[model samples]
Target: MPTKTTVPEDHRDDARPQFVLEALREHRHFVMCAHEKPDGDVLGSGFALGLALKAMGKTVHYFLDDEVPRNLRFLPDADKTQRTFEGIDPSALYVFMDMSDRARADDALAAVPRAQIINIDHHLGNKRFGRWNYVLEAEAATGILVLNLIGGLRQTVTEDIATCLLTAIISDTGCFLYSNATPSTLRVAATLQDLGADKDVITEQLYQTRSFSGQKILGRVLDDFVLTDDGICYSTVSQKLLESFGASHEDLEDVVGALRAVDHCEVAALLKESPDGSYRLSLRSRGRVNVMEAARALGGGGHFRAAGATLAGPLADALDRMLTAVRAEMEAERARG
Candidate 1:
């Protein structure tokens, strides 16, 4: 059992965590959720919190709008996540993790009374919509917030909980490669490691283990890659291309990162065609651009270095809109300088 250590100085004065802790202590039932397209940070953070609540003997139900990504399915309790809140306890407190907006959790969550919702997030431009919003924008990941909450509640971080929280931090920080991985973030990760987080398993499953179909899709997307003269790298993965290679959207999860790795690439964008004729855009930046501002302008939101949006597609129109957003942000960055 891992005992609580010194509280991170940055969060020591924030009463939001204490407030959220009280609410969780008061509630007998909880329904945990995150954004629709589940990712490592959201799923791992949600599960860590849910697991802690369950260990306290409270009823916890996990809900998400989509299936867990293949790479993240190895996390404990990943299989138990439900797609709907059907048969949910009306009195259950709703807990939204790693997302700024409730709509990102599910369209149905919008109708739930705001007083019953707790929003825990670390994204920029968060709405703080929860009755108890623990929004620490400077923190590397929402998992860090959850870890603080667990420490505040004086609960031991069991091995499984440690692994889940570590996964959240790892995913959001791009395995500590992203600039967001601050010293405090690394400290939290070290604590989790000491608490027995399986770094080997996480590294193997998240990066090393790639499906054949996923590799094919990656190759195809790279074959069609484009690098604009202005250091904007991009590529498109159409639904037809996915089907031809027998791939799922999960296969392209890291494609944008690959694009972002190119030398001199200031911004990288990958647009994937959806079944509804929309394109899901994943944007990444190398510090020169504020991708979140562009994503927010396009009705999406994330950190400055990584953000996303969905645009209605004729393919050509969607591609144009995405590039326009990136260019605008780049120009804004230059003007700010």
Candidate 2:
């Protein structure tokens, strides 16, 4: 697909740009938010857009429900992010970023006293849950689209903005190692780098650092890792395991990635017990399995290679059911040969 960057500097009939342009025209003071458990993609994209809007002299309230992970604190203006909507005007429009469902925004979104919502996301299963939904099913990350949106708004792309957007793309694409990272993804990365995005700074903060508790949890996961005969590797991060290691949900982000690195592991799954008592499953496929289909079969959504779902626990049974779908998909794919 052609990057929409070279289009004439006028209104195009494209729905994505039209939605963003319309929202900018319609809303002045806006509450920009992300998913409940915020990750780099959502936070980075939301913050980048926030910077762009603020540059235009608009009131932007960056609201996030979850505690920002420790490693991502180096973001230029992330310290200003809010967890509540208090003291802000009730009349502000709400912009949901990197997430489709309002429920994913959690309670922080509930108090927002506006009916107008603009949803910008890159999820395949986004239900178009906004007055204006600018979701791109094929975009690697929302940051990629937000970079285009910044250009759409005809705003200057500052170095700080480039860093935030670059972090979003790198985090979501697993450092451009995931299947979602395409030629266009790299082009965006190259452009961001040219705009002064510091790869060393981002890598130092995100990759070179890991909490002691997180490392302990990784040790446990590796010790108990399971590799089935069918090349399916899985790990567990139950509430009990978390308590034992004094680990937070934030730390398990890379445990699945580590599990995926094992030789001959076609699929890797990390099932963690969420604080809300549901089992959150993060899955990765090394090409032999369609994890997205497996996730959707169990009522979740994401890319073909990386997908996720939160199942109501008892985690044991939910994990079993999810794995059943994954195994079936693997077997079906193998049968296709």
Candidate 3:
């Protein structure tokens, strides 16, 4: 395939991708990673790129200390992900995907030599803490950037690679329902399909199928949903509630997105209790609200419409803090108008 197939004209002048491409060719071994508790875009992008490198006879290690959500286990090479960077070559280059910083991959990866790191992400305000940073906030998913890199190498995207890339685009775009799904995203999706991506498989596994326990847990979250007067819809999912339903954090994967879809809701927040009693707050917004700003204020980061933060919980206090940050972002957006 041609290199220009995925690289848009505006991105051509950005030399970071070329620099990263050179690094990929120079390295004999690599360790690919994504954020802890990763979503599809992270897993898919890592798997696709890792597979491509493997095809070139390069050694690739995928480090993912966290569990792969049940739905995403179908991704190519999903079973190959390592729980630790055990046996990693001392000279292996670390490729961080979808995360703004290396710490998001967990405490261990935080200390890796920055000069040996290749940061590829689509998050706003990325720290650029790597030897080569290919951060493009305008892209809907990191996989798009990976595709461009693969195309630059004149790689033939196999069926598995196409499937993984398509999943990344579909997952990050809410199956193309989110505002971030631009014409370029759709065109890329179309190209992947022509390359033999199984869209039906992706749709069936991600959307059509849902565990009974997950559905029940989602029910519990929505039953006590709170919609604030200013159009912020919020909910809490306690670890106790999850235990009662025999579900894990993965069950709540799409719950926040569902909340954002509610009528009159400009923003949605889900405060979930962790095993250690801390809280992970997931925020989503319809176009006007910049949930990322709220998340950053609370010590997190992501795109403008979607972001998250961690809180020390006595659940109520955490909820209060998250609400306060979100309300402040809402006010800021209104003031901008």
Best by lDDT: 3
Q: Give the distance in Å from residue 227's predicted Cα in candidate 1 to where it truly belongs.
A: 1.0
Once fitted onto the true fold, the runs of candidate 1 whose alpha carbons sit more than 4 angstroms away are 1-15
Better of 1 and 2 by lDDT: 1
Better of 1 and 2 by TM-score: 1
lDDT agreement with native, every candidate:
0.86, 0.81, 0.88
Q: Which ten residues in a row have the lowest lDDT in candidate 3?
A: 1-10
What lDDT, from 0 to 1, does candidate 2 have? 0.81
Tens digits of per-residue lDDT for model 3, 1-337: 2143332323323335777787788789999888988888999999999999999889999988887788899999999988777889999999999988777886778779877888899888877777777888899999999999998767889999999999999999989998889998999999999999999999888887888888997888788899988999999998889899888887888899889888999999999999999999999999898999999999998888889999998988998898899899888998999
Model 3 lDDT on a 0 to 1 scale: 0.88
Cα lDDT over the full model 1: 0.86
Ranking by lDDT: 3, 1, 2
User: Distance from true position, residue 45, model 3, in Å?
Assistant: 0.8
Separate clash counts for every candidate: 0, 0, 0
In order, what is each prediction's RMSD in angstroms?
4.4, 4.4, 3.9
lDDT of 3 at 38: 86
**Can you write out model 1's per-residue Cα lDDT over 70-142, one digit (the tens) per residue?**
8898899999888678868899989899887776777757787877888899877777777777888899888
Clash tally for model 2: 0
